[model samples]
Target: MSYRVSVTTIEKFRRYMTEASTFDTEESLLDSIKGFFLGNDKTKFGEAWGKIIEEGHKFKHVSGNLNGYLVDGIFFSEELARPAVEFAAAHPKMIYEVPVAKEYEVNGMTILVSGRTDGIEGNITRDTKCKFRTPDFQEYVDSYQWRFYLDMLNAKTFYYDVFEVQGFDSLVYDKKGIAWLHDINIIPYEPLYCSSYSDMHDDCKLLLRQFFEYIEEKNLYQFLKPYKSNA
Candidate 1:
């Protein structure tokens, strides 16, 4: 049978495995993946900035103000506006929001793993994040998302462009005296390396097998019923 799973869900499943030891088989893993779907939802900031970063990657020139476009009660502040525009203008040729998928056979079942990269230019895949604090490069290096992106995109290097958000109490102004209240600054982090590509690939394959086994044993479809009705 064909099973569809996202990278974020896979990450959550991995986290669940750490807390609960019940998912020892593929059936349980699949159920766990679907069981925690509601809890795995992205934050408003994550959703908003993700779109902005995707647009920046795709457009060569963005006219008008980005602050005009808001999603889920989140908007680009003055601090982020200039940099967002600049990043887009700078990388006109980069591929944005590229969907990628890789399929694996886990215990005779088809498991399709999928994700989308923020941007890709040359041999590097870039992921942008609007963070409240500085990003840890080592964390990214060990991330499942990073590894999956590398394997699926066939990227030589993975780069994270993290924007640190600075909030202000009073009204802030730009050089032109335009009211821009938030300050978004880019932090430094080196590109991550997949030194042991083969090992990572094998690990993912094993995870997929375990995930499917857990699902088969646990009847994961029951948890998905509520979500389907809501949809």
Candidate 2:
């Protein structure tokens, strides 16, 4: 039986497993980790924000994407959507939410990776990353996205359109916890992900293999989400 998953889920599992200390308890971490396989994502704000931005490419900020979003109402959500919206407008040719998929053979196990690209303008693929703090460009260079997307598209250049958001107005923290603002792009790299392009296949295979073994050891197979084919 082949397994189907998204790069999103794969990375989520790896992150939670390796950074287990971040969660409050082992059970909490396990639940959180399992939630990924159960088709649950905890980053609602980020997800909604991304959706709102994509809405811009098509010139709309529908309600569901902004539900309970910003305190200033839909206006804030619209505000958050502005930068990328403007960028895409300027680029004018980029397509948002483009689907791409690939299959991999990991230790005789077939695993399929499938997902949508955030934006693709010509040969350059782009993804928007929203950050609460000032972003270090290096972080963008190190993400799994660019390489994965690059391989899927067979494009050499990738972009990380980054947006730096500010914290809410506050009294205690020395930082001006205030008013606010953030721009973005998917113009895209990373250290561990620094392996050469030719090594990408091997790197991905190893990751999927390790991921398979990790889940097997943790006995998480039962929680795996049902992809259309897998279902």
Candidate 3:
């Protein structure tokens, strides 16, 4: 079966997937958005969320408690270290940072995307969630988070680290056995890529347009529904 994605969604997906940009404040976000809209920059919500979620996998707890924060710090540090270490581990010839840059194109409206990766070459591209069941890796298809980084760098495999956090005395059920496990779970994900950025962007834009149309239709229906009811 075929799926439909939009440029706006792809924009959002790419932002969501690319694993860089660690600004955790409202002001910085506002500044980034202003820059993107004004053409001063391109690191908007789409790309930011993509990368944010991607790195978020390393974090185990969605609850944001003390333990979670500890793990988060470790994860963030690891994310920073992954690129440098991976390069060092794989190729003794050269070392590089995770490529972080913006790509721009003029297709009627300006299209900008950020490229930040952990440089874990030959790894899977995936997102993490706080759920028991593993999510379908395909969910990141039009995700502005993953696609942006994957597209910008042309990565063949991606990973999602969905983590389930339990207390120190929680029991786990698995095919092997039912035993008490620690407070963290790790799930890795991989997605398939076929189209180019331009193609993905077109799909994202279409979805955004359709989303606006749906909102308008819903609002109109609500407005008319009351009138028809009175009649």
RMSD in order of candidates: 7.9, 7.5, 15.5
lDDT of 3 at 30: 32
**Worst 10 contiguous positions by lDDT, candidate 2:** 184-193
- Which stretches of model 2 miss by more than 4 angstroms? 17-33, 36-44, 57-73, 77-82, 169-196, 225-231
Off by more than 4 A, model 1: 19-32, 35-42, 56-73, 166-196, 221-231
Best first by lDDT, ranked: 1, 2, 3
Model 2, 29-90: lDDT tens per residue? 46644663342222433555566555543334344555222321222445555665566566
Q: Rate the local accuracy (lDDT) of all candidates.
A: 0.59, 0.58, 0.36
The most accurate candidate by TM-score is: 2
Model 3 lDDT-worst window of ten: 222-231
Query: Predictions ranked by TM-score, top down?
Result: 2, 1, 3
Which model scores highest in lDDT? 1
- Kindly give the number of clashing pairs for every candidate: 14, 16, 41
Return the TM-score for each candidate structure: 0.66, 0.68, 0.35
Q: Tens digits of per-residue lDDT for model 3 on 1-231?
A: 112222333343234334323422434333333333342111221222234333434343332332221121222233332432342344343212254433333232223333444334444433323334444445445355555555555554554443322232233345544222344333333324433454654554554444335334545223211111111
